[model samples]
Target: MRVAYYCQHVLGMGHFFRSLEIAKALADHEVDLISGGPEVRAELPPHVSLFRLPGLMMNDDFSELYPLEPGRSLEEVKNERARLLSERFLLFSPDLFLVELFPFGRNQFSFELLPLLQDIRDGHFGPVKVVCSLRDILVEKSNQEKYEARVVKRLNEFFNLLAVHADPALLRLDETFGSLDRVRIPVRYTGFVTTKPRSGAGIALRRELGLEPSQKLIVASIGGGKVGGRLLFAALQAFARLGLSGARMHVFSGPYMEASEFLALEKLASAIPGVILEHFTDRFLDYLDAADLSLSQAGYNTAMNILATGVPALVWPFDQNHEQRLRAEKLKQLGVLGILEDADLESERLAVRMAQAMEAGRRSGPAPVDLDGAANTARLLQDLAS
Candidate 1:
């Protein structure tokens, strides 16, 4: 089967990574992964091919859309992207058309997506089954009834399946988006999508970093570094205040952090003994596996990694949306980690929480929740195709 996967990551790289994992799982089939974010280095599996569109990104607040290339009009880029996307559909004629965060979110790209959907609905691309690939939690909007009606109309008209990447026992779609009963489509939970930790990867990494037996290691990251300036800054102050004996810290400020904010962290890290500053890494899960404690924002990918590695962590949900906060609160109830409220994001509060989390001890292994989403998704697609 041939799968055409469309993913547009406006503010962070989480969506791209999640989409890539699912594509990788379908290694036995032909896959064309279409991305509309600024180019970033990534690794895709053998059966997967990339189709990059003109890059468009959102501002920090997600209010404005702009091209990654300056001097290009947003209208022109949208038109070109729509044309390219339609061409891919005609050429590939995929068995499955999978879209990430559509109708429900990424509504900003409706200019292109709506046209593509119309083309598909008109039978221009014959008999392609459409699916919506959604994360566990959704951001609730005001006047949700009207918004949900639009989504239900679209999904019922164009989409065949809603593959929600989560465990319903832990969190169901209705918990966040209340109008699921009104939607007339088959919805299934594929469980949380994340990479499994390789055996001994953490031990090997610890040896490579020359971490001593007696030293305590803390791994900190800001997913994509788009809005973690406050968390990273507060972390530095908290690290200074703790000054735990034989404690070492490694911070990945994320690749998209502003240059000035990262430089400030670089200088600060230089002054602090046993502290290291770096950018993003593909081995993020390994770092989590090696850590005695983890600190970061609550994102779908990061949260899944922490769960897979059973790494005790301190997570601050990004406040612009309720998704992360709801996720954090649920996981906190499970006693898997600690939460630092946005209202209490001071150095002192962070330091206190970090210390408490570290004392809670590392999780022995992956959480009991479902973690076979990638493989399960591949099977589901194949079954649907058959």
Candidate 2:
């Protein structure tokens, strides 16, 4: 079987990363990936092929924004992508064509998916099942509740299934969208998408960074290029003030962080006895494994990674939108994460939160959240193809 997977995400690597996991699950099938976002270095399984759309990103300048990237709009780039895909779609026509959460997300850009879905439904396209895959939450941003209901209706009519890759035991994000039709599809809560670690691996990424056994590790990450220096600086201050003696810290300031700014942070770390700061390294999770605590802006992929790693982290969420803060609240309520608002987060308070969480973490284990979904998700996709 061959499957076509589509995703267009901006700012964070969550969408792409999740899609990658699904693609990995279907390694036996011929899968084609259609993505639109800033370029990222991801290890694609050998069976999957990539089709890059016009590089797209969210336009923070305007409200209700998903601006076309410069040098080429994803629309124009999408044309070439579509042209290339149309041929392959007809030739390798698969059992399913799965869209990752935004036959509704593009909002403005989804004008293309409807026609494609119509073709599939009307039998104009090859024999295929179209599925809409969504993550646990959908922070319904721009569209009015009524409009989303309409979109759900449209999706229900066109797609074969609405796969909610999250546990129903978790909170329902559909309430926020209020689309009975969309919610009513052959909806399957496939559990959360978390990458399982290679078990029994005790590789200490902290020791790799030259930290001693006595020092505590703090693995901090800001996704590749889009981190706020001011926000991160505040977290660093917190780490510093927390003042755990002989603690060794490792900071990953993503690719986009300014070199000059990072150099300053590195210098600051050097002054400290055991703190270390470096540009974002490819060894992200390894460092995560080595750390006693983690600190990052709350993003879906980052949050999932932390949870999957089962480490206690202080999530200092961005004030960009309420969704991040909302999740932060949920994690805080669960006592799985510590929260610090952007405006109010200080190094001193952060230090207190971290010191407390880590000291407590030593005694207790990760919360009783079941992440057995990835394997189940693999089985489901495999069954779909079969």
Clashes of each: 0, 4
Q: Candidate 2 regions off by >4 Å?
A: 61-70, 73-75, 181-184, 200-202, 225-228, 243-245, 257-275, 362-367
How does residue 278 of candidate 1 score in lDDT? Answer: 87
How much lDDT does candidate 1 score?
0.88
Pairs of colliding residues, candidate 1 = none
Q: What are the models' TM-scores? A: 0.97, 0.87
| TM-score, predicted candidate 1 vs. hidden true structure | 0.97
Tell me the tens digit of each residue's lDDT in model 2 across 178-289: 6644455677677777676454332555455566766788877777646556656766777777777777767777765667888877777677666667665656666666
What would the per-residue lDDT of candidate 1 be over residues 195-228, giving only the tens digit for each residue?
A: 9889998888888988876677899888888887
Each prediction's RMSD over C-alphas, in Å, is 1.4, 3.0
lDDT to native, each model: 0.88, 0.69
